[model samples]
Target chain A: MYQTISENQRHEFIAKLQPVLPEIQYYLPSFLDRRILFVMNKMGFADWQNFMSYLDNDHSYDAIFSFLMVPVTEFFRDSLVWHTLFHTIVPKLIKNDPCHVWFPDCSSGHEVYSLCMLLDILNVRNRVRIYAGCKSQQTIDKIQTGVYSAQCESMLVANYKNAEIPYDISKYYTINYNSLICNPELLSNVSFIHSSSLLEDEVPQISLIMYRNSLLYYTTDSQHTFITTMYKKMNFGAYLLLGIKEGGNIFGLQALFSTYNKDLGLYRKK
Target chain B: MEIATTYKLIVIGGSAGSFASVNHILQELPARFPIPIVICMHRLKHVNSGFKETLEIVSKNKVVEPFHNDLLEPGHIYIVPANYHMMIQSDMRVLFSTEELVNFTRPSIDVLFYSVAQSFGKNAIGIILSGAHKDGVDGLHDMYKIGATTVVQDPQEAQVPTMPQAVLDVMKPHYIFTLRSMIAFLKAHI
Candidate 1:
């Protein structure tokens, strides 16, 4: 006998599964099949057994999905973006003192490191205040520890070279068994907020908001809502850095921000 | 540690079928190969997601995406990230530019090859692999003029023959080999 999952049943499954599998829920629309497959493989069960077990245990689909959606990042993955920001953007932010920079959905903290590197290179680490928010506390802890893999170190070295920033990157980390633990001094001026992107009630007025490459998975309506929230949070003339392929005409919100084609597609609030 | 007086740097340029070629070459090289290998592959804009991870998995040596102002280090593979032109400095530092695209590619093969040739001169090795357009032709010629070792993938074996054939049409390289043979040649040289 073959059992079919109805749309309502899927929605019910998702609603039941969200709390335990937050990542999977976030990635559901885009990653349903992959998440299902991952859970099956993890449980060491065939398809039928896995489905029966999930059904019997009343397993939260969200928990299962969260386990599947990997949020891996490396330090300074894209160096040009950091270079443009340091050389062009941060200097402007420094000129406008009492600046606020918001990183919504900062996942782990590579984006944070990228920002810190910029502030350090520009010699204005003191001028700007950073507010980074993410949904996962585990990610926050990882960010707090500031430990990264050797792969991250290699990437960081490359980014430093590309930006022409002179800093001994090796000096920032102590090697321990193929892992590089970042110095604690780097996190002194930054503030970490453990909050969900969906639940944040009040966003402080910010001069620069960097939401890189994470909005691709959201539904069209959700993306509009998120961008609208960002528009509300940003002060006039605030700069927003988005993933290259992300900003498009969703909910006719294109006119709200003056789109600049620096590094493909970075937008500045008008 | 015996420091070699002269360091040989290899810059590989390719487009359409470059990824497979790179994997094939890197897989054949030993982990301790003591030379810097820089690659400039025309990548789609804003899609700088999996190049490094994929390359690192395939290659024996450490593979990473090049960052702005990074110093060139030996025993590593550096890939030019998407949407930026990668240039090498005489002091062996990396230079990144968002200057207008060359031959419609931001990470243009010609840009990297020309700068590397200028920086390393005779110590530089320039390789032109499979590509649809003739982006790296002039850069390979510049390498030839500067007495640098130039190699082009045998057109018959290349996925796209135009790029390698274009270089062969202008100046003869020191060696021409299929991808497999090219790996052997590079391994022997390094």
Candidate 2:
């Protein structure tokens, strides 16, 4: 059997990487304990020492950060969330004007497309603008391409069916060489940003922010900062959608948002 | 008698024909056991409504369907919630992913076992109970390689032998305890 890294080695690896990529400082300590070596091997380095040696300049930071990004997302994930958006939230927002929506931590564009699919169904496609953000530039570029490998088609279709969408899932996309290219028209007003929402201080005021399923990756302090910053940057009466697990009232932010749907983790700003 | 004093986490995975064994394990496990136990089973996403309730009825410890980013605390049996792959992030928080199904199962046995191996290393213990396929075998091997304690039900005694037999075929586990023997061993050790 192979030997795993000792506690001392794990600490040493974190100590070495923290200076070059300070963003990892906000990750859960246990996350580093499990993933530090997995990430090292992922970057084509044999061990911690080799990874440290490769960190020769400022340019190495991007490569290191890319290795940490988990691009594991599916289209129309959590069918209920999409159902709620299409049925309840989107209708409320679009009643005022064309709503500007933001999907921070867009995670390879699944959420953006899911929302676009809903907008298209509601005949509000021309009325909405989506700003999709992620920490990985490569993911942003991939999102811009609007083509997903067909491996996810079954799951996407299943989710759509679960959400009880009126049209067949195939109506939305054309299949090419095992890739599902989203209809170009759906992506017209979508902008992809290679940025972290936690770090972006000046994003456009949004009416709906879909920040689902990514908060646990950050430390508690970062989570707090993200909550308040998002609250400040959103328009009055804006809605915030978080991971279902994150629905509990955040400390000190109860006065700002009223719970819209606790099960679906939707909050509306006062 | 000192088994409970060792590992920080214990992960158990099962699939078809597993409920009986899981119930037995939970009933035998101590409420005050000082390690967190995470149980992952392959169940249809939409039909898992009663799973936590079922486990809590037998479990002496608190049985929880944990939220994303929920901290791992001792004296609780954490059940893998529906429609997500439960991963132990390097930050020690329990994270759920809507990632593609592995081994045709979300809350994949391989995913959970490998994560516990990575997070706890020698401080982890993984046990594979009755299951239909080979989902947990690779993960058990990963745990074994990391010096974590690995165990499998005696395939001969399992309701479905394919899963445990797969583990036995790969890495030699620390113990291959049947339901009765496993309970006896824990009583003796814990």
Candidate 3:
């Protein structure tokens, strides 16, 4: 449904895009290129010039942000990571006090919802406060509606099974009109944050931040900035969950935080 | 036979019966193979760790499952992790995406091959090994047309010839190498 920018033309696009979308300046060029092409093609933009002209003329990008960011990707993507989080990390995070969880890049909310089901199963749903970060209200509304294609049901069930969920996943959602409607109670302990970015947001006292598959897109400088920012905001005993690929000390921020589980990308704030 | 063209990255795409051939190629390579070899093979997504571990045991070079923005380094064999589409950047960094599936697979060889062709152009080497799908054909075509060196495993010897046959049907690759000849070619070039 969309056209992609050629690799030859990437440098030019990055040059044009940085001044406008400063936040994405540090994103890995390949990933940003895909997202840019997706937005331009989906928005009927003939080329980068046309896309830029529209952005210049419109002076608004709420729609662009909606189109650019991906939503509701793999649920419990790496089941081992999810298993580690529930079994190992969460217990330490919620040692005594109620835990405040953050999802700084909560695109479309499937991951957060997966956590909601997990938290509910743990019966500590009442003790955790989840902050689902959103760039626009469209995402909030979409997540609140909690409707997904029935086609994806098999994968969800499969991931749930792989994660070794004790309860049947079917109880959490009902299929209607070829859509899976998540139970409304899933959002009981969740709070939506419009502040958008963890880098800029001073939202404090987070016990855990589920920032998986996200840091890989960031440039080294931005990754350092993020680690530094989280170091300040996260409580000393809090935890951070990155993507599984972020294993083996790739982030190299050990001075600030200790590696709780290197393979699963779970860390503890020192 | 010596390959005349200088290359920066070598990306190998395989599936089904290519595992043994891939193992052969990696096992034969010396410790300091300068060009980074990126292997994108279709494996069971739920079955992740074992494949990497098995490859590690056989290969001389260090096998790595790369994250997004992992800088391409010499002497390391980058194996595309299961369940994610892996791509290469012009800056020699590996990238990952969970966006969607292509050709009924997540770590689609086409995605990685096409991305490398676009980013590395003629400097990259594209190799198609034995498999049962047509995933790498279009991607190999892209790399071939872009002036990158394209090699297809000998279809006659391929355990599952569908993938190699599919590539042969589209465009004749620069070199059609058997398992031994491919290792020799790689060792000679490096």
By TM-score, the best candidate is 3
Give the DockQ-based CAPRI class for model 2. Answer: acceptable
Candidate 2 clash pair list: A28-B91, A30-B90, A30-B91, A30-B92, A31-B89, A31-B90, A31-B91, A31-B92, A32-B90, B1-B189
* Candidate 3 per-residue lDDT over residues A1-270, each given as its tens digit: 123667656766566555545567777666777777778777998666677677766644667778877664656778887787677777666675868888988877889889988888877888889988787677788889988888768778878778876787788899998998889789988898775466655465889988887776677778888788877878876888887776543455777888887777788888
> Model 3 compared with the native: what TM-score?
0.89
When sorted by lDDT, best at the front, the candidate numbers are: 3, 2, 1
Arrange candidates, best TM-score first: 3, 2, 1
At residue B9, candidate 3 shows an lDDT of: 94
> Which window of 10 residues has the lowest lDDT sum in candidate 3 chain A?
A1-10
* Whole-model Cα lDDT of every candidate shown, in order: 0.71, 0.77, 0.81
Better of 1 and 3 by TM-score: 3
* Per-residue error (Å), model 3, residue A174: 1.3
Best by lDDT: 3
- CAPRI docking class of candidate 3: acceptable
What TM-score does candidate 2 reach?
A: 0.82
Estimated TM-score for each candidate: 0.55, 0.82, 0.89
Q: Sort the predicted structures by DockQ, highest score first.
A: 3, 2, 1
- In model 2, what is the error at residue B16, expressed in angstroms? 3.5
